[model samples]
Target: MSTETVNPVTGKIDEQALVTKANRQDLRFAIIGFVVLVVVMATLFALVLDFMIDGVPRISGEFLTNYPSRRPEQAGILSAWVGTTLVMSATAMLAIPIGVAAGVYLEEYAPKNWLTDIIEINVTNLAGVPSIIYGLLALGLFVQIFRLGQTILVAGMTLALLILPIIIVATREALRSIPLETREAAFGLGADKWQAVWMYLLPAGRPGILTGVIVGMSRAIGETAPIITIGALTFIAFLPPAPLQDTFPFVNFDWLNSPYTVMPIQMFNWISRPQAGFHVAAAATGVILLSMTLLMNGLAIYIRYRIRRSSR
Candidate 1:
């Protein structure tokens, strides 16, 4: 099926000209896309290289275990890392179930009416709202109104709010990706909506849902503004009380009430210092942060892969 036709006036087919014109357009777009990709990769490579060169040698066992100090040589990220883990753990626990449930309700159970439409629109809009705004809101509501203070709990709750819309959107998308026939088949088998969703649609869509969770968590983990607005200390010197102390019950909710700091805040504090040693330490902290983020993403990918395989 040739697209070309003879130019009757020239008494010859213009097939070669047409093909060349089409190929030229395709090649132009391809080259542009490739150049953009190369530029992005190059930029990322340069940043990673800088971190390695200026950061890696500074990383050591002492850096991992010791607390922050006024002296650059003595400062470590012990409290920062601990706070990050605790806050992220709390954030995930609070956000995932609530966010996913909201998404499922909106996507699967809610009527296609004006109220649902408005709610959906707001959720979508919130996803794009500046992170700083979430910080401000958390400062007012979580820190002041709730009287949570500058604890890991407050920071976690604030971050949970910040990433909630993202998780909801992601869950809705994942639910939507499930085939309509699957639902229909479940109904035909005498299953209720809840059963269909729980037994069939949820498992089918778990991978996409997990992907969204990972993205939301990643965003939450890296955020500084919200935590800072809630007055998260930048120079925390001690770990929050352990979740499992030697108390009778063997569990401590009091850890949530303690002061906290995170990797990003710590890195920011270091980078702002006048000392070159602090600068190097900042880069090393960046390396650790980057590594943790990558590890989280990789684990999510592996989990997604496993879920997909199991479903098959």
Candidate 2:
């Protein structure tokens, strides 16, 4: 058999030489990949070590509960963390359902027409738009027009808009991954459209949907520009309203209108301050933020694995 290449200098087919060359190419690619992996691992290791050295000492109960103060030693992240949690919770609640519903409609129900084409194009375009633009849009529509003010509700809603396109795209892609025969089989079994979607499609698509949601949320948690543009206070000394009330109506929404700050905002404020202690505190806060993001990603992976196993 002839080899893949002939020697240009000798003008002869050399099968052994060609095989050696192919092996070398493969080896070189593998070596490059290994180097890249090593570099990434080293970077993460360095970051973790730095945080531990500078931040661990400051990670006390007092630091967790104390409010922001002019003194670096007295400042804490209570309001910042609480605000982050509340805002993220609200964002997830608003974005996930709406985004998934829109995705389902686009993928399973919408007609293949110019209108749908326009919508698809817009959705894709929206995903790439600068986050600050979404902030501006939220500022104009939610804050200025609707008069929501600079509050947790407005911030959560803004972040929801930021991640909506991502979730929708992920949902559509997940739905597409299901084999067409599966849907056909469901229909053959006398399943209606809603039944087919809810019973067969959504469950199979859950892994991808969950992956998208967590990834989008990671981005939301790190966002600072949009939140700042919407006037989130960097120094939120007071906690927002409580979820429960002692009065007649048990639930309270007053927190939605209160001022808030998130981890990123808190870190920003600390890093910008003229104090070494504050800088260390910022590093500690980063460790917390990183931990949260990693935890979310791990959960997504676990859930996805379970879904795949169940499907199998």
Candidate 3:
């Protein structure tokens, strides 16, 4: 039997070897270019980073865990650490349900029609929009729309909106990757749509969901504009209070309304200063942020591997 290539535009059969040679060439160039870019970027970063740490104490346990200080040689990123964690966790809490649910509705239940197509296009477009725009949205709407105040809650909700599309798209792709046979099997067993999607498909797609959630959270964590726009503080003397509590011992709802700060903002604020010590602190902060992102990515991969291996 002869192969045929269907022209997408002309709707004519035209069997071609385009996907073969073009794909190989594209992959070759992409890998080469990416390697070159990484090398050049790393070299430049190393050169400049030398200036930032020429003569500064690069290690101290106190510096790692204590709160920031006006004193150049004495400050730490403890508060910012806790604050970033709080903001990110809060963002995840807000984003996961909405994003995953949207993905579920679109992937598992939506009809193959114009409406679903439009929604899919919109989601892709939203993902491409600049992150700072979402920051502005948080500033304008969350701060002013319903008067949520400039708090972690509002900042998180804003970031949730910003990254929800990404999560949805990733989840949808993951869901689509599920073997069609599995869905049919579930259906044949009298499983409802919801059950097939959630109980079965979702568990199967956990790796992808986790991957998406972690990536989205990383973006939210690194974001400074929206939080700054929503009035993230540079100084907070205390850790964030628990989400729900009146007055047990040390927990309170003060974090929702009070001024807060996060890792990126802290790094930004410190790096902007004129002191060498602040610059070193900035470098340390960079390492911390990098470590966090890498750790999350690694954990996600590990979990995915474990899950896939077990499922086999």
Candidate 4:
């Protein structure tokens, strides 16, 4: 038990004694929080280590380069990885500019009205919506109405929809973190709202924005349900057409309309097979998927660090 003391000289509560008691409480809480963090980290590390142990030996050049096959020994992730790369590229190209622009408009330009409030609330709520829901929606809209088919474009659009809310929220939060004084100073210098946001606020908040983009993409990469729901093939042996051509107007858009499968879908297909070798292949795919996610996050962190260092 702890006791509070009164200062005999001033007939007041002892500030130093109160501070000591508060510090003790804070220290106890801190220790508890640290213990919880360690437990979570250790658990995650163990799971990842198990995957690595099962999968690392199976990873090889041929495993990466060959297409999926009925024979587990011959099966590889070439088409899946290539499709994933193309889809992610399309998703990033579509989502970033649109999400960022919507965020900036909502934060800096939108009036504080009921309609804006509803939109904001909806955007926030959409972030928690299941990926499968987006898939169903995309199937109805993009696939049926737009006749996009179960192609890379439709897949990218679906994932883009899934991650848009995340990027918007991140962008708004990043912009909001800029100091009021900074905004005032920009205004005082005769800079317009657009100039202030484009020049100062964006550069200042880029690290946070990039972090959010990385997080959203990481989530998108391992998503299987949506991709499956959108009719991604379980066993695709063919690659998308090359984006570059030898003829005039060399950049081709044919690949966007090509049937595709992502890493998660490929892994799912492998896991569903009864063969133990396929299970091993699934574990290896998980390892590769995890590695790709980590590499993306690492690259984002490096870029953020560089941005901060340059700004300083």
Candidate 5:
């Protein structure tokens, strides 16, 4: 009787080669599945794009950067441009430090306990909740509880909360990716635990943190529902004032506290109009938004690559 032998180098048995051949054949079916997915996504995009509408050229120079006009045909999203910049600036201000710090604590300092478990669970779950619910929470808590009013400040804080969980999770993953040997080496070098994490873990995780914040900010930029709920005025003709603070001496809160609008809200305002021109403007607005999101993603990728290269 002849027995089949397993090749240790390739980890293939005589009979297993036959199974591998069948698996290779199965990959062709997966390619079909992927092609189907791409086609479906493209079809959906065509249906939703403002540019896809027949014969409407709404993207004029004025439309790209002009103030809102009483005439829907003449309205541009300039104020919304200011609003979005302000909102994102504010969201980044609040979200990055708080989220990343919390993540660092959990990853480096937190003990494995039921309390931490519950926190981790809640943070994960919070990320999945509808943006509208977060908006409602902002309306009730930030606006109502502290009476911040429906201004940009209130909306910014609310959005900060919405993205906080995401940043924290990303930070943890980045921190976790640092090898245990690195931590032990730091310990061996007579560095304290905090110092070890701050010096090595943070640098290693910096890329992930940057990427996470950019991704979070990308979503935050497009969030109209939450800001709308918090009273981001649909149309404003004025550029928001530069930030000024009497106490801070040079910081202006107008950049932070004024009635603001962002690109998404402005696009939404245009899309809702009865005018056909405004619909075209909405598509143009989407193009602008897509550009910004892509830019942010690119920046994040660049930062990650640079850091990884330096570390290597």
Candidate 6:
């Protein structure tokens, strides 16, 4: 009995040696990948830590309540943060339903054809298109043609367009991840396509869908070029009209048409100033923006976990 795994035709060791060689290659690839990941993560961590060290002490009660001013110490992000919130609310409202519906239709309902293929290709390409392009488009379509002005509504619509491709791609990919067997099982249970998708597939894919939504929003929140191009004020002294009115309906849509500025633009304004105090203010704004992004991602993770646990 021979111990070696020999190829009888070649009369040499073959299977065993090949298997050992392949395993070694795999191990080497994994080790290299891990090292690269660690290096990238460490670099990012260092940058964020530096920001926190410089900015954390500068954040004070007044900083959150006051508006921008020539005196950096007196200037605050009150208007910037409020504008960011309202614009993000509008972006999410517009982007989520439209993007998700487009994705679902293309993935499950649309027939496989050249038109669908072209649509999918364009969508994937759009995800990689520069953010400035969306800004330009918004300037033409929303600002000039539609006469929406460079208001909060226009900014929101611009960002919604920028992130639409991301949500759509994420949605289609998430749905595609569902096992064919799962779909068959749903059909076997006498559920129609729409019923199965709504009742089962969508639920199963919710976590991934939510993850995509959060990621798109995170990108949208940090975007400056589109907002700047859309003429977001660099130094807004006043806040938009309050969404909650004191009388009548109690809720008003007046803020949508009001001029606005977001955190990134505010930070940019500070950074471009010659004063060191303004630089410090910029760093502080960065910290707040980063915190907001992390909070959104954390909330998404928590929601996804709850959904998965409940399903199980």
TM-scores, all models, native as reference: 0.87, 0.87, 0.79, 0.85, 0.82, 0.83
Q: Which regions of candidate 6 fall more than 4 Å away from where they truly are?
A: 1-38, 181-191, 298-312
List candidate 5 stretches off by more than 4 Å.
Answer: 1-31, 44-61, 244-248, 298-312
Tens-place lDDT digits, model 1, residues 118-137: 99899989989999998999
- Which is the better candidate, 3 or 6, if ranked by TM-score? 6
lDDT of 3 by residue, 97-212 (tens): 99999998998889999999999899989999887788788778777888888777887788899889979987887798799998999999999988898779998897888888
Candidate 6 backbone collisions, by pair: none
Query: What is the per-residue lDDT of model 5 for residues 1-312, given as tens digits with 9 covering 90 to 100?
Result: 123346657756667665666687699889999999999999868754645453136667787678988676677877877777788788899999999999998888989999988988988899999999888888888888888876777878888999999899889988987889999998999999889988888887878888899888988888878877777787687876777645757876656657777888878887788887777677778777877877887898887788678769
What is the overall TM-score of model 2 with all chains considered together?
Answer: 0.87
What's the residue-level lDDT of 102 in candidate 2? 94
> If candidate 3 were superposed on the true structure by all CA atoms, what would the RMSD be?
8.9
lDDT of 6 by residue, 40-93 (tens): 999989988988997888899999999999998998999999999999999999
Distance (Å) between predicted and true CA of 51, model 3?
11
Local distance difference test scores for all models: 0.88, 0.90, 0.80, 0.90, 0.81, 0.90
Report clash pairs, candidate 4. Answer: none
Score residue 263 of candidate 5 by CA lDDT: 87
Better of 3 and 4 by TM-score: 4
Q: Can you write out model 4's per-residue Cα lDDT over 75-154, one digit (the tens) per residue? A: 99999999999999889989899898989989889999999999899998998899999999998999889988999999
State the displacement of the C-alpha of residue 3, model 1, in Å, after optimal TM-score superposition: 25
lDDT of 4 at 123: 97
